[model samples]
Target: MNSALEILTKYWKHDAFRKPQEAIIASVLEGKDTFALMPTGGGKSICFQVPGMMKEGICLVISPLIALMRDQVQNLQNKGIKAIALTGGIHSDEIIDLLDNCQFGNYKFLYLSPERLQNDWILERIKNLPVNLIAIDEAHCVSQWGHDFRPAYLKIVQLKEYFPKVPFLALTASATPRVKEDIMVQLKLDNPQIFTKSFYRDNIAYMVFETEDKLHLLQQILQKNPQPSIIYVTNRKSCNETVHQLESLGFTATFYHGGLSSKDKEKHMQLWMNEKVQVMVATNAFGMGIDKANVKTIIHLHLPQNLENYYQESGRAGRNGDKAFAVLLNNPSDILHAEAQFISVLPDKKFLNLVFTKLCNYFQIAYGEGIDEQFSFNLNHFCTKYSFPTLKTYNALQFLDRQGIITLSQEFSEKITLQFIIPSKEVIRYMSLNPNDEEILLTMLRTYPGIYDMQTAFNLQLIAKKSNHTENEVLSLLQKLKEKNIIEMMAKSNDATITLNEIREDERTINRVSKYLEAQNKLKTEQLQAVLQYSKDTKSCKNKVLMQYFGESLAADCGICSYCISKNRKKQNPETVSDKIVELLKIQDFNSRDIQKLTKLPKDDVIFALQKLLEDETISINSNNLYSLK
Candidate 1:
């Protein structure tokens, strides 16, 4: 432990291991199968990383999130640790080279996506590597009942046979007991050490508001709360809509969702991280590896599919242990809409069969011939061409992924740049004729690596702008260099990573998977309705009810929520009109403009209400900013 902290200080700046991290690290080092249930900021990665540093062989980490894998690998490299994530989008030769590096180059960690388990050649290569530990991130996905279960996770269990002596460690931030048990069964853990952190977060206040006008309620929360907040809506369009609304309401807002281009997503994320954007309106796709510690609030415009998702998103707030609020804005129709979304994705067997045949046709493979072909799909365009419902077709594809028909990875793209292939001496010799051109060429050589290995993809316009040359000049120079065998260049296209299975699935198999998916969708709809039931319960504390749903028995009333406030005010006032007025004010401050925008009520009525408030001095408005008694 002394050497550990010394290395930690020498490299990572921290002197002590976070709570539960040391124990998990020690267990893994002792060659024990460990299952860790820690919160978001609980230092889960250190449990495997520290032990990997102390062990004799590499630790192969299986993660389900590509963005998370990229971020963690980059961070590890930044700390001078050797780590690699062999996910989709890379060429097959690159994967083979990385595997060879892991086996012979003394790489300590090789992070892989779960879908990569389907690659038999890669598995064969990994089977020969000296893997001391297998770490599975987001282990809850093994459970069918879990919120984000991926079918590829089940194939991970086969690696246990390849390395019988190696210990397996599973980790997840959110899971019910059922999910935990499913994880154990899926991984085939043998009396593994199970560690669970208490789910109770005493510092975060949970609040839910029932209202017809949610945008106004959202504005009120933002005005009163501190910065570095997140607002979650149901879809990409809603994320944009909410951001526009907030911007009009005089707040700095940016939107994010999976549908955005990778460059756009990264730009928005960087802006938010730099505090240039005070609030982000996004779908649930954001915030897996985002580690901003001072987020003060999370507002949900629609109910999440389950508590696991809600908890994971809300947990992003108050990570620095300060006070924060997790508020949900709900209307009666919101639950119905969420339910409809769940139902829309349950594909019928007929559609599933159609998708299977269409996929084979599109790839130009016969029924029995698509064994080793790799192809990318555009789901919306594919469905539009075939006249199938897009959402239902996507669901069917997911079912196919589950049935081992094909691997459908979530969409991801990254900005990668590289430059020329000549040795420095020859380049310098060529550049000695013109010092200015030599300087620019030498600058490219010094800044980027792996330039000589293959055709380099880079932005020609940016390079020309920096070099003060025309785009045509740059192109001609690059072309001349390539013809001289001094460089090779290939720009990256918008390519999706995918691998198809060898066997064509029969109609029977498709039908079986479809039935199972439909059943699962039905269960999800029911669970969502159950959460809505808890939300509508007026007799219980909102926090207590939510905690109880996650199996907490002694959870108490949260005194700050709408239900609690309403109860206390009802007992004191005994006047319905006064309580209604106060609740309405909590939703929004009504001035002439707000009233005119919303209601058909006469201006006299609105003016009378404002005068009454001014007379009592209970509220005031000036220059569109509203205020209540401080």
Candidate 2:
């Protein structure tokens, strides 16, 4: 076997490991379990991947994030490494074939979703693979106490029975002490060597600006910051609105959300990634697996509900160890609105049951009739039909899915893509052989080329229109074609994939997870309060606050933070009234006395504000020495 360093240098072209990576890899190579708590951009993948490359058998990676898996797999493949991800919506036969390839096909890595572990057939097949080390990414999900918990992770511990000798490596960027303990116990990791890199990001200047005019402040920040920044918003409307606001100001900006089609998402992401656009105003969905290193600024327009999310997103910045800012713009309304949207309407038992019943009614599934059945759920249609708040109802569905009541995937089918497994002549022959499915098949073939060799992205609506069929008809035909092997279709995922986990029961049974729901609600509230406190905090060093939240410590204040800089500025100036006035004057033309009336500052402060504005040349003193825009 090649040494780990040799494999790393050979594939990654790196002569050195990033901080704790070497030690974590050493533990895995020594056949000892490990909990690697590296930061978001801390080269977590290299820790497990290098060891896997050096090992004899394939590394089995259990990831909860589909996007992460896809990105890693693509990156590996780009590096001439053999890796495959068995994500959702895959046909069983394809999964078996992929697993078989991993076993005997010399595949280096296998990335799969945690949900896939529930399949008995898959487990049986996994037993046959020469799996060396099992690496669980996002291991925090196993901890119900963690922010992004997934119950499917509880089933991962059973792997020990099949691969008793294989070492386990659990990796996460954000996990509290409680979450860490839960992960070790739940995964049954055997005396794992725990490696935690210090959470102190000395290079990141943590900033919290309490401002009522967030948009104006945002514009100012954009003007000051360098290119290729990210603006995270709370909702789709805000994302689009921010993009529009930036565009109106002549900035190259775009928006991304889960609602966008796969092509559109990829296009927008690529545009931003390639720096074709200077900024990407996106929801929480846009930043995983991004390693652009030079993200100079990340402004959270709304307060993140928890520090974990804030830390992870902030960690995205300053990855290059250069000066970067993780800024949160908040006002009284921002926090209050965040609380109401995130915590208040978290769907109690009545609300959950109401949504659940409406869901059943909408699907026309009678009680006890739709067990294990699947349906394409459109949240907008359901909410419009029942006149429910989109966000609250969606959160209710998520909670239900978490409780194993139903499975809701909002963008599942949107990522589903397909390719023709056969040649064009064979496709035409098969089209001739089957008269009923020709239109859709021909439409697909005519619509996209290179489908024979690679996965081609597809749109059911477009295909349906070209074939003169409804979306359902197009989907059924595609699946039927896939079954016949004329074309291979990725399992459809765009609609909410709702699997009635159990036969539809009455309100009493559906609300059985009420206590669990209440606990979740409580946890969510606590999480919100934690972030709120962080936002409201003025006495603590921002870096210290973040470090303590993650159970770490910093030797001293990161001097680059807003608070530390403000303190130093205060010591130097002792009076900031002039600075505040300059800010408003820069926004528009304002005479000094009018600025005083608008700002209601003392005469001395107003004179100071005017003098500062003139000195800074932000506003010119006219013939009368009154301040005006330069």
Candidate 3:
């Protein structure tokens, strides 16, 4: 095996490793558990990928997103390195075949979702493979204190016993001290070598604005900034509304959400990535594993549920290390809205049991009979039938999912699968009629073995390239083959999947995880309050506050955040503040808060400057308490 440096240059085409990359890679290679806290674009992947190449056996990469797994696999294959992603929706037979290949075929990397680790069959198959390293991406999910806690991540602990000698590498972009310790405990990492990069991005300037008319302010922001921006909303409906308004203002804007079809999501994403669109309006569902470097701005119309999410999302800006802006637009009512829509909607013990009973009845699952069973879920139809409020009911389902009672997977896309139904003789006969189809089918066979055995996720784009045919031509040939009964083709379909872990439980079985759920709700409320404080506070530098939140005591102000800029301007130039206030008041009588917005000054300075003007008799207050220059 080549050294890490050799492999880095040979494969990734990089001459150097970023800050702690070399040390982290070295630690993993020395057969030690490692935990790396890197920022979003901190090249965490290289810390593992380079080491994986220097090892003798396959590296098991655990990830959270199916799209991310597919992307990494495709990129490796494009670079002539064989890789595979064990995504959902694949039939069991195909899974077995793929695992069999992993065991017998000399493959280097296997990208898997944390949820997939809970399967006994999957665990069994993974035990048989010559696994050299275990890399858990998004490792913060293992911590109950983290914002995105996935109960499935707990199953990763079971791997240590199976691969006792293999080193584990856990990576996350952000985690507080409590969450950090929780991740270490939950993963059972043995004295792991920890590498933590600072959460500071000097290139990004954090700015927050409180306004009544967010749309008008958003327009002004879009008009002043560069292209290729992302506007994140809190809901799918807002995604459409924002995009429509932006487009109405004569901008090339598009919207994306989980509600959109797979094709539309891909279309809109590509349009933004290719610079065909100037802006993308989306829910939080967007911007995971996205590698756009030139995004000049990211404007959040609402506060994220937590600072971890806020930091991760804002880090998307200025990835190229260029000057960029992260702007938050907030309204006074957003706090009340967050409380009602998020914390208050959490289902209590009573609601949890009811939702469980209703869910079992909704699925018609017999008591103690539906264990390990899967079903396609239509929540809207179920809610309508049972007269359940969608918001509260959905929150209950999420609580159940987090408690490990069952697994609920939504927010997925369509995948194409092809299988051979008839004998090879029929396929040959059809190929005889069409020689070009013969070449394409042969190319698929050469590319992916056992396509005749079961349905598999065939790459249409890759197949077109290999067969020297356009994608339309490839689809046409597949349709031709399906029409002639040469192969069975499954068109892309997108929906949610729910798998019952045990029989639907009443109070007894449900109570086992009840305390955990209650703790989760309380933690969520705390997280919400934390973000609200960050958004509302104007006295401190936003970066310093963020760094302190993560337990770093770095006292230096970023010096350029909106808060610091306002603070410096106000303290240094009190005269300018008074002048701006007087100038604005001369136009029309206004309150102190409104004057702050007009002057873009700090609240304290606005108040102080207003007092100075009144004492100097330069401005007078009316009976309504609106101020004006006299």
Candidate 4:
């Protein structure tokens, strides 16, 4: 195989592989199961991608995030590489055709979500494909102990038996030692090579300021560094609230969370990526697989659930390797609120059982009825209308879905139009013959290029404008054409779907799912509490604390950090004005006159401070007499 260096330069446009990527790729290329622990922005995708290119057969990548699949496939397509994403967005008939293509087509990679594994026909077809590698992304979800664990991921472990000799590569940007080992065991890797990278960024200055005036602090940070940025909150409601606050501050910003429709989410993402909006106030759901590298800052309006997530979010900043900041604006009550969030996940078995039962009934699935059906789900609306505890219900549903009861997708449904029908000339001639429908017919032809190349639906408004008609007129004409078989139209996405496994005779299955749900709640609560401890732990260096949470051991303090500065200042001097002034001068060099003004002491005291500073050589005065840090 060619060197990772050669691959890096030839395709990825990087001078060299990032830390651990080279080692990880080498291991996987040698046909070893590999577990890669990288923080966000750690070049995790390249580990599997580079190897996929070198291998002989298609690398089947299992990913939980559908949005990430679309983005990666699109990026690969842009590079003129053949890749496909088999997700819930496609129709059953199309999925069959795609599987056939993968089996015989020249596709190098196929990306799929974990939920798709439940299809028996798909699994039957997969066994015949020449799969060379199985890359499990976000592999932490396979572990019961992982924070974002999915029950659907358990089926992933069974894939090894089906393709016993195919090498496996499990990758994740966040995983503790416990989660790491769990991933290895769950994937059933045979003597896997593990690559763990240090979770530290030298250029990212960490700041957590206690503030009551959050809007003011946010305003100051945005004004100070008005580059691309993200403000992360904990929930959808909070996401909107934070965006509203940022908007009121005269900043152009947008909000993103799991709650928005796919169309709106895509529009906002495009706006942010296109630089039409400089800020995106969102929840944790927004950052994964987002390739915008110029994000100069990431502000945490709420405490994240764990350091793994915190590290990943913070690492998104300064991706261009420039000096940036990860600021946390918190209040004293933040810890309490955080702790309350944790407790909300610590519900009892009875509570979980009630919620699970409601979910099965809410979806109108009798025992074992929704084995493989998929449907769209709206979390907040579902919880509010049904008067259920949202966090508890969400946890319960995740547990139930994991236990193979249903598929709960936490993604927005997207709207897509395909103008994938008739050639432009053919359409124009047909419209000419029907002069009464000419305006609407020509609108579709003019607005969508797909009409000339493939069968597809065009955006109603754009088509209307082109044909010199209103959106309604265009839609009516399209419907008429579709009924006459002259064209076809399909709206993009419906909600998530859950197929009941068919009516089961055993009532004990309910108890099994309930126990798992209760256990999940407790685990999530513990994870959130760990975050609270990280926020309030005063006895340790903040950076060290974050490192330790990610399962890293540090030998030294970050000398430039706030903790280091605070400690060094306290040890230097307290009673002596000279030492205090010297330390201040070292931090920020000031002229003797400016020192005099800042100290507000007598001229003699200022001179004494300057004399002490000069004696210590902590600072020096220029020939212009402007003092500066040495």
Candidate 5:
């Protein structure tokens, strides 16, 4: 058998194991239950992969993130290692074949979701495999206290009954102290060897700036740094808008969001990864399994839902150990906006019951049935039919998904393909004859520049909005054009797929997870409050604050954070700040905000300097409220 180090070098091409990885791998190899709490970018995968390679049989790895699972499987395959992931959207026959291969094909690893374990046939097949180690990625999901708790993770402990002697390795990048305890309890690890790496990244300078004009500040920061960076926004609309803003300012940037097609997502990701674009403006969906080491900056234009998300996102920078920055741009209005978007949309028990009942009724699922039944789901149509609030209904469905009640698949959603069958001149003539279709046709032409040449998958919602018509109206018009032979159109009207994982019991089903629902809602609220407090903080060291939150203590302040830098600036001679303000006034009229930006001083110090300059008669306030030299 190859040794752990030999396997690592042979497969991963890394000569040395990072600190603590060797020790954790050794524990797993010794047949002991292991728990690893490493920060993001800490190479947690190596702990399991190396040990799994050294063992004789295939390793069973379970993860909640389908994308991450696919990514790791692809990476391992690219390295000539045998690996397979049984994710969603796979045929049952193929799954059986994959499982059989795991049994007889000399496969080294099998990756699957925790939810897959609920199937008795899958469990029986897994029980028959010669599994050497059971690796659980994102192990924090097993804990109810975790930020992303999945009820399916509770079933993971049943694997121990199947493989009693197999050592289990559980790993996560973020888990609070309570969550850590919950993970060990829920996974039922026996005498688990625990390894925790400090969350502090000395190379990352955490920065928080309060500004009303975020775009202006963003421009300044990007211009000054000009390195490969990521700008995080809250939604798809903002992602595109920010990219446009950056491009207009002569910066190369691309955007990524959940709404993008898989092809577009890969295209944009490659553009940023190859440095064809200097920046990637994206939502939180962009960073999983991404290992770009030289990202110099991670800037958040909107407040994250919680500090865990912020830490995970910001930690993406400076993975190469050089100096980097994690910047958060906040304003007073952001607090209210975040609360509205995150907290207010949380569905309670009653709401969940309502959503579940309506969903079953909509699908025509009889009571105490509907297990394993799948249906194409049109969220907008359902919400419109029932007059349900769209956001809350979506949240309720997500809650059902997390609770293992239903499987919601958003893959390949919102796809509308169209191609002009007639010549462009004939299409224009048809459009002119049909005045009502003229606007929508023109909008489609402008939005998809290549529609005349080839079949194109376009965003129906975007076309509806751009054409100033309802989506139904746009679809109707497109259908008319298609019937007239003006164009060929195929619209996948369903935006998601819903699979019933359990029988429809309506209130009884919701009552089963009521306590968990309440607890999770409370936890989310507290997490948001903590994020708000962190953003409003001005005195504490940013690194120390983050470390303490994750159950680590720092004796000394990190001198690179925004707080430390401001503290050092305050110790400078007061005359220097006053001199800078005076020089700016001599050049032109200025306000306190303008002076603060130009002089790179804090607002308080800028105000103080301006007051002193005015008292000394070296500067005077003009009628326009701008300070000028007297």
Candidate 6:
């Protein structure tokens, strides 16, 4: 067998392992359960991939993110390594064939979701494979204390029953002490070797700015940096608006959100990655599995819900170890907004029960009989029918999804099914009567073979393309046809698909997951409060604050963070500070806050300098409370 370094050199082209990766890989190769807690961009994947490559049999890896799994599988395959991800949307027969390939096709790696372990047949098939290693990525999800906990992860421990002797390697980029402990216990890691790299990023300067005009601050920062960067927003609307704002200011920018099609996401990502665009204004969906080494900054236009998410997102910068910045722009209103977006939407037991009961009723799922059933769920329609608030109902459904009660696929699309109720000759005659609608009706007729015999689903875009009309035009013509009783049409706007993961017991179903829901909601509240405290903090070293949150401590302050820089500024001569304030006042009337922002000094120092200038009769406050030259 090749050494881990040899495998790394051959496949990854890395000369050596990073930090404790070598040690962790050695432990895994020695048939010992291992836990590696490395920070983001800390080379965590190598810890398992190298050891798995060195071993003889297929390495079974479990992850919660489908995108991450697909990305990793693609990366491995690009390296000429045999790997496959059994994510969702795969047919059972295909999964069986893939498992058989893993058994007999000499495949080196098999990636799958933790939820896949719930299938007994797959488990039985996996039991017979010569699995040399079991790797769990994002292992923190196994713990209830984790920020992104998934109940499906709790089922991952069942693999131990099948592969009792297989070494399980668990890896996560961020985990608290509590979460770390829970991961080990939940994974049943026996006497596991634990390796934790410090969360400190020496090259990153964490900064938080309080500003009412966030757009101005954003422009200033981007202008100063003028390098590849990511500006994170809270929603899709913000993504587009920020991009437009940047474009109007002569900045080359693009945006990415979950709502974007795969093609558009790839196009935007490529534009940013190739440096064709200077900035990527995106939601949190854009960064997973992306390994850009020279992102100069990660800026948050709004407050993050938790420090864990903030840390992971900000850590994207400076991967090549050059100086970079992680900036958070905040205002007084951001706190209230964060609370509303994160805390207020949390579904309690009552809300969960209501959503659960209503969902089953909405789908007409009889009591105790909805397992594995799928339905096209139109969230807006459902909400309007029940007079439920949209966001709250969506959150409730998400909670149900996280609990593995129902699998919600939020891939929005318009579903239209239609059939010609009249005879073919009558339909042709009616189409000829309406000359304007002739092309679209004929296009639908040609596109769907069984439209006249039965209600057939069709792509509106394809119909529009074939008929030389826009989707809206085609939809309008279809509505006209329905009005004229030429056809039976059923149209619904669906943003998600609901797959029942468990039998319908109504409230009983929700009652089973109530404890977890309550605990997670409380945790979310605490996490949000911590984030608010972090934003409001001005005296603490920003880097130290983040490190401490992740259960690490530093003996010295990071000299580059905003707090440290401000502290250093405070030590400047008072007269020099006053001179700078006077020069700013020389330009125009300015308030103390504006002076502090312009001078990049501490609040007290700015106030002291302003007082000194006033005392010296060099500047005076006008009726508007702005200081000017006297």
The most accurate candidate by TM-score is 5
Candidates' C-alpha lDDT? 0.75, 0.83, 0.84, 0.75, 0.89, 0.87
True-vs-predicted CA distance for residue 130, candidate 4, Å = 0.7
RMSD, every candidate, angstroms: 7.9, 8.0, 5.8, 9.8, 9.1, 6.2
Cα TM-score per model: 0.78, 0.80, 0.82, 0.76, 0.84, 0.83
lDDT of 4 at 300: 92
Which pairs of residues collide in model 2?
412-493, 412-494, 413-493, 413-494, 414-494
Query: What is the C-alpha lDDT profile of model 4 across 528-594, one tens digit per residue?
Result: 7777776666556678877777788778876555555556653323237675566667667677656
Q: Local error of candidate 4 at 162, Å? A: 3.7
TM-score ranking of the models: 5, 6, 3, 2, 1, 4
Candidate 4's TM-score? 0.76
> lDDT per residue, candidate 1, 524-553, as tens digits?
776787778866887888777766766665
User: lDDT tens digits, residues 1-630, model 6?
Assistant: 788889999999989888999999889988999999998888878888898888889999998777788889989999999998887555577799899899999999999977778878888999999999999999998899999888889888888888888999999998988899999999899999999999999999999988777888888899999999999999888999999999999999999986665557889999999999999999888798889999999999999979999999999999999999999999999988998888898888998898888888999989979776667778878999998887789888878877777777666556788888889999888867788888888888777878989988767766886788987798888888789898899877676678787788987887788989888989999999889988889899998888888888999999999889888863768888888887887788887768888998766778887888788898889888899998
TM-score of candidate 2 relative to the true fold:
0.80
Who is ahead in TM-score, 1 or 3?
3
Model 3 per-residue lDDT tens digits across residues 247-350: 89988988888767656788999999999999999887788778799999999998788888888888999988898999999999988887877788888888
Cα lDDT tens digits for candidate 5, 1-630: 888889888888899999899999999989999999999999989998888888899999999888788889989999989999997655577799899899999999999988899989989999999999999999988988899899899999999998999999999999999999999999999999999998989899999999888998899888989889999998778998999998999999999886666668899999999999999999888999899999999999999998999999999999999999999999999999999878999999988898999999999999999887777788889999999998789889988888888888764465578899888899888878888889988999998889989999766667897789987798788888888888888767565778887788998899888889998999999999989989999989999988888989999999999999988874546799998887777788987768887888777777777788888998889788898888
**Candidate 5 residue spans exceeding 4 A from truth:** 378-381, 414-489, 493-495, 570-588, 597-603, 610-630
486 Cα displacement, candidate 1 (Å): 17
In model 4, the Cα lDDT at residue 470 comes to 72
Which candidate do you rate higher for TM-score, 3 or 4?
A: 3
Candidate 3, which segments miss by more than 4 Å at Cα?
371-374, 403-405, 411-495, 501-509, 570-630
Which candidate tops lDDT?
Answer: 5
